[model samples]
Target: MARTATAAAAPRAPGFLRAALLLLLLVAACRQAAEENVVTELRCQCLETMKGIHPRYIQSVKVTSPGPHCDRTEVIATLKNGQKVCLNPESPLVKKILDKLLNNEKWN
Candidate 1:
């Protein structure tokens, strides 16, 4: 009777410890995932921008207004060849194209 009681108590202690360790690991993983998601959302999409891309080469334009991630307006142009380029918002040609697109509501 004494041997069986000691064996049962020993197994119960280790089982409880294993369950606690597993719970701690799960909580840590969830915390890491949440932090990574927030970091991704905080980063800007455009890293480099071009000054003078011709309107004829552009297939479409997407203008993103400044917010939490970036402070300035972003203009992304998709070329006819399907390559995307970031356009300088302050450029004269870019401004003209933006005006045309806005007037026609052609920007995505």
Candidate 2:
């Protein structure tokens, strides 16, 4: 009777572990999707905010990964004047400041 009980329990252990692992994987995927959406949104907003600037001074806008995780995406702007600015999406204040610097009407 003891040997039969152990055999049944052994099969159940693997099933429970697999279910837990699958749940964890699903949660991770959802989190990654959300992070990607946030990055896309931030990129679009940066572009719109900088559109008023002179086209001649704006060379390119690109998304760069600052780290392993996609949570900290840097929006890099290259200027015709040989200047580059990296904007961090993690900080609202920094974004506001960068917007003013890059899109100011007085900036050449």
Candidate 3:
């Protein structure tokens, strides 16, 4: 009876401590995610702000949402110099532009 009680007591203390540590880690991750995203309202659509760029200087492209009422899947072109531009991917002209940039082909 004494040995059984000692073993049970030892495991329970460590088990509770591990659970507490895991809970703390999960809370920290949630807080960090919430802080990283701050949304604002935009009066205009995303495509209205599109600009032209030379394919040679573009490094990569990705999708991001800037605000509500604007297109959610708006494409962001990242230049080699760390500058970024918003683009409307649904347009035929923009598609041609991205294809030219990604394929490393001359834009005619």
Best candidate (score: lDDT)? 1
Write candidate 1's Cα lDDT for 3-104 as tens digits: 999988998998999999999999999999989965645646789999968788899998888988788888899999999999999999899898988798
Tens-digit lDDT track of model 3 for 1-108:
999999889989989999999999999989977876774334433545465566667778775554565546677778899987777677676788877767878756
- For model 2, the stretches where C-alpha displacement exceeds 4 angstroms are 41-103, 106-108
| Regions of model 1 farther than 4 Å from truth | 1-41, 105-108
TM-score to true structure, per model:
0.60, 0.41, 0.43
Task: Point out where model 3 deviates above 4 Å.
Answer: 1-48, 64-71, 90-92, 101-108
Worst 10 residues of 2 by lDDT: 43-52
lDDT of 2 by residue, 1-108 (tens): 999999999999999999999999999999999898666444333332332334456566566664544445566667788776655555565465456656764433
The alpha-carbon RMSD values of the candidates against the true structure, listed in the order shown, are: 5.0, 9.9, 8.3
Candidate 3's displacement at residue 77, Å, is 0.3
lDDT over C-alpha atoms for residue 87 of model 1: 91
For TM-score, candidate 1 versus 2, the one ahead is 1
Q: What is the descending TM-score order?
A: 1, 3, 2
Residue 26 in candidate 3 has what lDDT? 97
